[model samples]
Target: MELEVTLLGTGVGIPHSGRAQAGLVVRAEEPLLFDCGAGALLRLAEAGLSPLEIDVVLLTHLHLDHVSDLLALAKARWLMGANEISVFGPDGTEAWFEALRSLYPYLEELDVSITIVRPGDEFSLSGLMIRAGEAVHSLPALGYRIESEAMAAVYSGDTEPAASMRKLARGADLLIHECSFPEPFVVTNHSTPLWLGGTFRGAGVKRIVLTHLYPQTVGREEEMVRDVRAGLADETKVEVGRDLQRIGV
Candidate 1:
C-alpha cells in the first residue's frame, strides 16, 4: 500500500477561514490520525473519511489545539457503534486522559486505550514502524517518524527547531512541520520559517509541507517559502499545506 498523507487541519490554535486546527491522516495499511485538534472531525469528513475508520491516534502533546477533538471523535465513534480505539502519545498522556475523564465522567465509558510513550521508543502499528523523539515545546512533546518498507514520513509537532527533531526527520520522504508564523515573529514553543528551514535543511529532508499556520501567516506563504528556500538546498521542495491536501509518500 502506498503511504499517503492528508492534511486534515493546517491551522493553529487560532481560528482561520482557510485552515482549521492541527490534524492530519496518514494512510498506510490503516489510516492513522495525528493531532486531532478542534474541528478535526469535521475536517475528516471534508477529506471523505469517517471518524470510525481511524482506530489509532498519535498525539504529540496535550495542548488543547492538538487534542481538542479527542472526546468528539470518541463520541462520534461510539454513536457509530465502534468503541475500541488506541491512543499513543508522549509522557503524561494517560494522566491527562484521566483528568478529562474525571471532568466529563462519561469519558470513562468510552472504550479507548491510551499508551504513554517516551522519547526514543519504537513501536509498530498498522504494519508501520514508528519512532518518537523529544521535541522542544512549552510542554512535554514528541516528534514522530513513521516508516514503511520503502517510504518514510516525519511529523514535527508543535515545536521549536531542535536536534532530536532534526535527527528524527533525517532522510524522510516528507516532513510535515508546523510553521505557526512567518519570519522574525519570534514566538515561543513554535516555529517560524527561519528556524524551521534551517532544521529542514540540516535534516536533508526531500519534501516539506508546512502546516499549523496562524492567521498572520496565511497571506505570507510566498515569503515563508522564499525564506525557507534561501536556507535549504535547491533540490529540497517546500510547499504550504492546506486542509484536505493529499500527498503520496
Candidate 2:
C-alpha cells in the first residue's frame, strides 16, 4: 500500500497568500506529523485530519518556523482527551522540549515522550523505516529518508545544499525539498534553485515537490521549477508545492 503524504503547510516564517509554515504528514498505520509549524495544525484540520489522530511528531530542527505549534498540539490533544504523543527529533530535542514544558507547567499533566535522534541514525515507526541525515542550516538540522513496503520518500527539512541529504535520498520515489529562493541569489543555510539543482545530482530522484517557499518566489514559481527541472531526469516530475496538497508514495 502506498503511504499518503500531505503538505499541510508549505511556506516559511514570512506570510504568503495561501501559504503557512513548514509542515507535512506521512500517514502509515498511524499518522505521523513532521514539523508542527505555525499553521500546520489548522492546515491539518483543513486536510481532513485531526490533531488527535496524530500520535507521532517528527521534528527536523528546533527553529521557530518548524516547531512553533509543538505546544499547541500538546494542548489540543490534552483538551480532547487523546492519548499521549511521542516526538522524535535531533539531539537537544529533549532539552528544548523541557524548556517549553517549563514555560507551560499547566500542560504538565499531558504525557509527551521525546526521543533524540542524530544524523546517521535509523528508527522504525508503524510499518515504515526512517533514516536521518545532516542538513545545512544555521542551526543543527536533519533531513529524513522514509521507506515503506514499496515506496520511499525524502524530506529536506531546511537546508542549503546537502550531500548527506543527497545520499540519503538516493533512488527515492518522492522528494519534498525546501526551495527557499530562486536563482541568481547568494544565500547561506537556505536553498536557491541553482544551488538545489546542483545539490540533487546523483540522487536519482523520481518525483519532486518543492516547499518552504519565501515571499521572494511570489512571481517566479515557474522559473524556479524550470531551473530545478533542468537538472533532473526527463521523466522526473517536478512542481512547486502548495498547502494542503496530497500525494502518494
Candidate 3:
C-alpha cells in the first residue's frame, strides 16, 4: 500500500498568511483526514482533492483551530451528494457534535457517525492500523500513530513535549509534530522548537516535520530547525512543514 501525507494547513489559532489552520491528509486506500481546521476544505481543494473523497476524519482535540472544519466538511460533502463520513475523536466528541448540530439545524440532515476514543485504543481505518495515545494538553487530546504495511507515521496534535508522544513516535518513518512557537515562549499547552528538541533527542523516527506554526515563527524557520536538530541525534532528518507539502510515509 502506498502511504503519503499532505499538509493542508500549517498555521495555529492565530491568523497568518500562507498558512491556514491545522489540517492534514493521509492518502491510502481511502483518504483519511486529520484535524480539519478552518481552511481545510479550501486547502484540500487546492491539493487536487474533493471534500467527498474523505471517508474518515480523525480529530485530535476539540479546539476550534483543530476541528472547525468538521462542520464545513460535512456540509460540503452533503452538498456534493456524499452520504456519511466516520469521525473519531476524544471523549467529548459526541457532545461537541451535538452542540454544533443544535446551532445549525441543517447539520441534522447530514449522516455522520461519531466514535469516541480513549488513550491506548487501537483500531483499523482503511487497512491502516492506528494507535491512540495521550497528548499533554489543556484538553483531553490524543496523538496518533498510524502504521501500514509499507510505512508508519505519527502525528502530534496540539501537544506539549511529552513522553507519550515520544513513545508513540518511536520507529515511525515520519513524525508530524507541532512547532507552535519559537524558543522560550513560556507556554504550557503548546510546544516550542527548543523545548521539543530535548524530547526528540535520540528518537528513532526517521524524519520529523514540524507543523502548526504560529506567527511568532514566521521569520525564524531556520532557527527553529536548528534548535530541533540540536536536540535530535545527528542522523534524524528535521524539516519545517509548509502548506500543501507532501511526503511519502
**Residue-wise lDDT of candidate 3 within 22-89, one digit each (tens)?**
99999988899999999988999999999879978999999999999888888888888887889999
Clash count (model 1, backbone only): 0
Displacement of residue 197 (Cα, Å) in model 1 is 1.5
Clashing pairs in 3: none
Residue pairs with clashing backbones, model 2: none
lDDT of 1 by residue, 1-249 (tens): 479999989997779897888899999888999999998889999998988799999999999999999888988898888878899998888888778868877656787799998899999999999999999999999999999989889998899977888899999999998888998898888888877787667577889999989999867999998887777756789999988999998
The pairs that clash in candidate 1 are: none
TM-score of 2: 0.97
Candidate 3: lDDT of 190?
87
The residue-by-residue lDDT of candidate 2 on 1-249, one tens digit each, is 589899999999998889999899998898889998999989989999987898999999999899999889888998999749899998889899988889887888888899988899998998899999999998889999889879999999999878888898889999999999888778999988767877786678898899999999999999999988776535677899999899988
Candidate 2, 180: how far from true, in Å? 0.3
Candidate 2, lDDT over the whole model: 0.89
Ranking by TM-score: 3, 2, 1
Best by TM-score: 3
TM-score of each: 0.96, 0.97, 0.98
